[model samples]
Target: MRYIISYVSTVNPDLSNTDIAKLMDHVNVHNNTIGLTGILIYSEGNFFQVLEGEEEIVKRMFERIKKDSRHYNIIKMLDKEMNDHSFSEYHSSFTVISDHYSQTELQEFLNKEKDYNPEHYKSILYLTQKFMKLL
Candidate 1:
């Protein structure tokens, strides 16, 4: 079985682009090394991320995330075990929604995956929408 976790949080406003880039690099390397896959989206001052991998590792990573000083107001949107990882093809993805076009692209990408798992997709889409609304 695979474990998946999705959450939204506010990033530290003081973080510069360079800081965020470095953070993303660390996340990618760490997650890939642990055999995890998922997507992370940031916009305005908010962050939305989904992580899928081994149950223990994902849960451990989430705990570390909760303690990370760079963000706050962590609100978990989803946490459960599933038969497969919906985003196994991607090692780890990070996107910044800077404008309506980027947001639209993200929506389209999620829309295209609607058939993968309706329940999961619905929840993921809803979380993204909710995260976007924070912008």
Candidate 2:
């Protein structure tokens, strides 16, 4: 009964990187205690998070996330049960898709989870691609 929920949200402009790091630190500890794993990508005031774990726990966490005051306009791009977690090793990976990931870096990120269901990530990938083009 594993689930992966991917969503994007508009982050509060006043929040700084240090604030995000502190938040992720707390989230990582809490997620680990509940056996959840995922990555969080934030760039240009947008947050894309992929959360995976037991169905009920994941759903509960998502519900809390939706109610959090830190972000708003959350759009869930994918939500489905899966046999395995794509982000097994990372509790809460944070990435900023900036100029630092131009050549081999960005490709490295995309190549890691090629076996996962592409349909589940099509919208996020499309947005990432478009963002890359602008850089």
Candidate 3:
């Protein structure tokens, strides 16, 4: 069964843009290699990401992310089995939302858990879609 794991983390202040680019490249390569898919959302000082794939593979990837030094305060926001992958079209899409939204708005979305209303999930996916197009 496919599973979706959503998480939030705070990027370390010391992290450099080059480090982020290298990390993104590494994630893209690894996700493609393992047939995993997901979307990454970054706004303000937070990192929100949703990874979907086989349970074991997703879990392994999360474990590696937890050990990464570029981010801190890693928190799993959602993890559940899904009938389908919401982001099956992309190995991984990274989005930076800093246009007009406030940091609180971004945090509210990132703090959402699986128990949140279905409409909320749809909204999140919609925003991700919009951001994906921009990227």
- Lowest lDDT 10-residue stretch of candidate 1: 88-97
1-135 in candidate 1: lDDT tens per residue? 988788889998898878887887788787878888776766667778878889999999999999998999998877887666556432333444455554554555476447555766776677777655532
TM-score of each: 0.74, 0.74, 0.68
lDDT of 3 at 100: 38
lDDT of each: 0.72, 0.69, 0.64
In candidate 3, what are the lDDT values of residues 1-135, reduced to their tens digit?
987787778889887767676766777787867888775665555576778889998898889889988889987756777666555423332346444333333344334433453645665555444444442
Candidate 2, RMSD to the unseen true structure: 4.5
Error of 3 at 31 (Å): 0.8
- Candidate 2, residue 56: Cα displacement in angstroms equals 0.6
Assess the local accuracy of residue 109 in candidate 3 as a C-alpha lDDT between 0 and 100.
Answer: 39
- How many angstroms is residue 44 displaced in model 1 relative to the true structure, after the best TM-score fit? 1.0
